[model samples]
Target: MNNQIKLSKEKREDMIALIKAYFLKERDEELGDLASGFFLDFITENLAADFYNQGVWDAYTYMNVKIEDLLEIQKY
Candidate 1:
């Protein structure tokens, strides 16, 4: 599977902004636009898949519980 994920220009900028905010808030470090852009690129390239998989797993677990609840209601 191709591991490349593409983001729209607006979304890219938003992610960079978020990264900058994170650095400033958590690390007390000011991250420039260029550095934040590079950090976003690195995260998207390296970690997006794992993040996506985790989201899918979470959704699956939630749905299973909901389905079980429905089934139990139907048994009454």
Candidate 2:
């Protein structure tokens, strides 16, 4: 199973822009495309999996609740 998360080109650009803007706003450091791209890569490679796993867990919990509700309705 492929665990790699893939973003569309537009999404990638948007994220990069957001990263650049965030650093510029909060840190007062201007990040160029190369720097921001590297930062994005680092986040994507290292941190995204953790976030993705959390999302998967959240979805599982949500679906479980829905399934329980469905079962309850059937019991009525």
Q: 1-76, model 1: which lDDT tens digit per residue?
A: 7879999999999999999999999999999999999999899889999999999999999999999888886644
TM-score of each: 0.74, 0.89
Which number leads on lDDT? 1
* lDDT (tens digit, per residue) of candidate 2 on 1-76: 9877788999999999999999999999999999999999999889999998999999999999999888876642
Candidate 2 yields a Cα-based lDDT of: 0.93
Highest TM-score: give the candidate number: 2
Q: Model 2 reaches what TM-score against the true structure?
A: 0.89
Model 1: which ten-residue window has the lowest total lDDT?
67-76
Off by more than 4 A, model 1: none
